[model samples]
Target: MKHENAKYLRPQHLSGLELVRDICCGNLEGGSVGSTEVTLTPGKIKAGNHTADPQTAGSVGLLLQVSLPCALYADGPSELCLKGGTNADMAPQIDYTIKVFKPIVEKFGVHFNCDLRMRGYYPKGGGEVVAKVSPVSELSPVNMTERGTISKIYGRSFVAGVLPYKLAKDMATTATRVIRREIKDLYINIHTLQEKDMACGSGNGIIIIAESSTGCIFAGSALGKKGVYPDKVGFEAAEMLLRNIRHNGCVDEFLQDQLILFMALANGISRIRTGPVTLHTKTAIHVAEQLTQAKFTVTKADDENASNDTYIIECQGVGVTNPHF
Candidate 1:
């Protein structure tokens, strides 16, 4: 769909689908998402190499979020060559999508692998990523009401283009120091890196993650801005992660919404424990309900020791299967 106000977007690639306009949205001067037309073929959308060029610093991660689900039900597998921002200010960072979202989505039985080929920053966007998704005939439901043990804490602080590598190291050092002060007995490792090749524009960002033994993942991230101290960025990211840890939910707030569609499409009942419901999650739930026959319920979790912020999201999926698969 091409809107007057929308930026560029990549079309979903399925075996049986035909498309004239791929995810090539507007130029640097963004536009709205007013779709003019759509065409379809006999099988699922034709799966193959596709590209999404937002021209501006639009999000490649957002492109995947819109297309990956459709690819799962495709006639075959899909390989996407996405180009745009890897670490946008508004969308999920590429790292969070890979590290946190990928694991949780795989639990539903579909699998995909992503490799960042280049680091794309805001304004003049020139990042690239290659993602391969394996088609699944049916999806399995998930159960993750318990947060379980926090097995590990790890992160990465990255700098690219004209950004100094010292900034990355500074962010990592400060974040490690902050987290260690709170939890003393876990393996804490935050790596600092300088993007050596094909890094578009100067940029820096930090991501901190906590992985639960039960497969739940939570994360916090902070982007480096002009005039902001690297140490302050690290402190902010650590604090964001710590706040999620304090929630004690099975999943992070951001993860809550992303799973709604999968839960609605899975084979059985799916349940998860999460922190406060985000507006994005609510919107996803509404969209899922409108598009599928799935039923969803949101209620407070029955844990006396838990804080008031904890809640349970349960979905009765329609057990939809791929007809072409």
Candidate 2:
């Protein structure tokens, strides 16, 4: 079957799963298994919904990461009902996409929403999410230079399917305690969710976010495992967020990498103060510089306590516009 806006479908092998990417002109589609389909339309990328289900449990969050940005330059608004794993090992979860990613992008005029219909976990792979995207004429530059005072910290701990509600509560409580120990007077609120039968597969996870006065956000997350105690999961996530904040970065390490391509595509100078640049960010910068005419520079922060751990990233955008739309 052919899709109107569809461009091509090529098979890919990863983690012992044979899959196909239903790539469109403007964006790359991470499709599920099955197909020799490839067609390229020489025009604007039209919006369309895709299903990546059946036997493969692909990462819906990964799909969104690639899809939403391209959709911003699409011919029109896009709606996607992506199916596969909502929570898996080594990929961003749906909650992170909503709580952390979506809010940060709004600062740059990118608007999108994800409505999760079902929670799909690993192996068994039955998850569904409805995502909506609105095209933008151009992306606005963002500057996050200083690590501002933290206003509040909010968190969510969820257990789905066969997992017990106690696990979710335990995770939330432990995470709250750990964060409180460090912040002292800081207020922390964490909600617990027990997804009984509403989700497709069995799994549990925790996500914690800290919001600063200057609109910067930092987060930590960890997924539940079979033998690992719930408290351990909570502690891991808490430590991750704490480490991120202690580095005195305007944004977390992961966000630094996530913003790389967006910075390159933006209209003007985009500056971000972040903790030590990760190898991921390094690779992303290299690829963006190679692909687009965007120029990027990295320099150490000038703070009295600044060491190799803190640095500033600046990007001069190529000013790519949505003329096709």
CA RMSD of all predictions: 4.7, 5.2
**Alpha carbon lDDT of each predicted model:** 0.80, 0.78
* Candidate 2: residue 92 lDDT (0-100): 81
| Model 1 C-alpha lDDT per residue in residues 1-325, reported as the tens digit of each score | 2223233323222211221123221122212233333232223355666666666677778778877887777777788877778898878899999999998899999799998888789877788888898888899999988888788999999998888899999999999899988888997899899986868998999999999888889998999999999999999999888888776798887788889999999999999888888999998998899879799999987786468888889999999898876
Q: How well does each candidate superpose onto the true structure, as a TM-score?
A: 0.87, 0.86
**Candidate 2 wrongly placed segments (more than 4 Å):** 1-43, 304-308
Q: Which ranges in model 1 have alpha carbons more than 4 Å from their true place?
A: 1-44
> Which RMSD does model 2 reach against the true structure?
5.2
| Candidate 1: C-alpha RMSD after superposition | 4.7
Best by lDDT: 1
